[model samples]
Target chain A: MKNNFRNSKLLVIEDNSDHRFFIEKAMKTCLSEVSAIHMSTEQQAIAYMDSCLYQEWDLPTLILLDLYLPNRENGWRILEHIRQMPTPINQIPIVMLSYSNQRDDIAEAYQKGISSYLVKPTHEEEWVSYFQKLRSYWWETVTLPKMRFSF
Target chain B: MKNNFRNSKLLVIEDNSDHRFFIEKAMKTCLSEVSAIHMSTEQQAIAYMDSCLYQEWDLPTLILLDLYLPNRENGWRILEHIRQMPTPINQIPIVMLSYSNQRDDIAEAYQKGISSYLVKPTHEEEWVSYFQKLRSYWWETVTLPKMRFSF
Candidate 1:
């Protein structure tokens, strides 16, 4: 059998250029072959997601959502929009990656139904370690639904 | 500050007593300190969850659901039930453990919003490794919403 994740793509929604640079760097180091799309704002994310619905596009295998685009509320807004998308699109696992460890933010993220919440690391090396664990779980250990279907 | 998971509890809902035994054994070997509650039937699972609402019961930090109580449809039934429960109760991450790897089953499990899908290992040693990866992701690396809230 061939590798199931040969074409897996990760969609990252993060606005901070610094964080975005680190995310791509980490993915390149940890899971080099997994292509990623970084949308720096809520509007870009919505437009790209909407475009996927209309055009022949390969929907992302997983989503990494940054909890704030200057405001945490925007995180909730984009998450709601994605969750409300049709069928398997909504089913795509959205792991929230945020710098905030505030109880209210974590609690509310769960209340609104994020697949998992990860506290963003501070240093570049720590970011690599973070993605290593992320890769170990999502890529190596668990079976992802995205590998099996497309429309 | 105290360890957040000081009082964390795991809820395992499996109809097979044999599988139940293995799961418990794995938890002890890997995460001995975390208390576990195992329910052997769908009714028991529902009763336990419902009772938590009225009593001073501790809500499970994580739920491990057996794909079938002899039939796969039962997994969906119980999952939908739990997903509809009130507030943070519905927010608890439910990891579906199953022997079936049918594309349809995996796809539908995601469609229904399972936190993740794991394939049940056939050997005792493999089960431990499975739980090890599980522990690595869910326990050590990621920040679960469960550790932070209560009704």
Candidate 2:
């Protein structure tokens, strides 16, 4: 895939250090022009989103969301807020990248209007290949709505 | 995947005999419980759908729609009619499976609310694998809206 054609950014929200490192390492070979921003806490993610809104920055094209968080609000709440946001922020494609295998979680996420739900692959190669295909389709093939809000 | 689940049907509307055979063969390995119904002409497909409605039978779970059909009305017109249908047929997932590589076709199909757009892979093995994944995700894994009315 042509790297220049898809320069969309990705945000990864996870609390685990090992998982963060694994994602970073695996993404190197899988996707082209992917820049991932990570946060260890749900508060941090909310704060980051707040800052982005204040600064009027373009939202990431895709978000890899984890269901669990450090404290207080969880990923589902965050997703709900994002979906309810005005204008461009509401249009960003958010995919649940969680280890939770519960059918209810999957069902609930889809019901809440999640773009996609993927169980975190166990192996590094599997993770890489999965994200590669995901990036290729979401960024290159899919006509994603713009995510920059204007007053 | 367990093959004991409620069997979902697939109606593939395609004009090419080879392509129909290819899809049927591929679907057999991946979707054992799925009953695939294929039609080479628009008249036959419409007739089948109408007959299902007339007999008060449940419609197919999903449709692998081909854009080019041998009839007066094109695929889009059929799709529009399906969307306008009164009962269970209105809610069926219609994933467009087409050979058209044109960007306009892709854009228009999605704009018309296609569940998914899949390009026909050139390689046989790749086609099989791709269709397997499609079957798993779209047919077996995803829980579609319940059929409200038969026909």
Candidate 3:
């Protein structure tokens, strides 16, 4: 049976303008009906989340997080804060998008309850395909609990 | 840069003959060149694993496991035994495949270090699609360290 829902919405937390633009272009080119909210700073991401809560919009289904950012604290700290949030928001899947594939990075992400750890690809086509495959599999196939279904 | 390896070898640890046959057929149809092995008993599975070690073949990329089996003990007990084994085989990814979607079941599976918890789908297509997508995303697209690579 064909899935009725459009591709899942995503929140991308990355500091680099070029990388963010590339990812947005890739998603638009590959996945269907996926909208992304990109934030360059941790403060901006937190502000957007607060606004989402205030406006009562459903939180994004997946978060693509870059471990390194222009901000002082970095992405893991943001993930920690989001995980501490009361409900509805805490359940969103956060996948780490990082350049480092160090064992420590993988171990720490798993320890912090990140859904998945991915090493960013060097090639543009590979990167695009990564998100395309992610969309096709995770958003289209997996039966994740909707925001309304969350506590 | 498309991934060269598009399929994964999977081991399904379950005792029910009907369910095993259903899953086997599903994998054969939905997956491309996937090697699927089904073991009905823990003793048989462990025995097969021992034989595989002598053959110098790599461990299956993912394990789909049922929590309950015909054996007197639970699957978690078998998982505990696997975790204690030395390197090489100890690192295989185990995905808990079960009909139980209870919160406690999910929590316990994660606690015991299951790679993922999949609630067995009622429909055949959904079941086929679930395993196919998992193989595509986790095994094909993601970078899983070989047993020899883990430090």
The per-model lDDT (C-alpha) reads 0.80, 0.66, 0.68
Specify the highest-TM-score model's number. Answer: 1
Please tell me the TM-score of chain A for candidate 2.
Answer: 0.86
What is the full ranking by TM-score, best candidate first? 1, 3, 2
Question: What is the lDDT, from 0 to 100, of the residue A113 in candidate 2?
Answer: 50
- Per-candidate TM-score, first chain only? 0.92, 0.86, 0.88
Q: Tens digit of lDDT per residue, candidate 1, span A1-151? A: 1143567788999999999899989998987878898898888898888777765356887889998887987889899998898866788888999998887898788777788888888777888988887787787767777532442
Look at candidate 3 and tell me the lDDT of residue B73.
Answer: 55
Best by DockQ: 1
Q: If both were scored by lDDT, which would come out higher, candidate 1 or candidate 2?
A: 1
lDDT of 2: 0.66
Residue B80 local lDDT, model 1 = 89
Q: How accurate is candidate 1 locally (lDDT)?
A: 0.80
Error of 2 at A15 (Å): 1.4
Clashes of 3: 0
True contacts kept of each: 0.66, 0.00, 0.18
lDDT, candidate 3, B61-94, per-residue tens: 6677888775325687767766555554655656
DockQ of model 2 vs. true complex: 0.12
Positional deviation of residue B54's Cα in model 1 after best superposition, in angstroms: 2.9
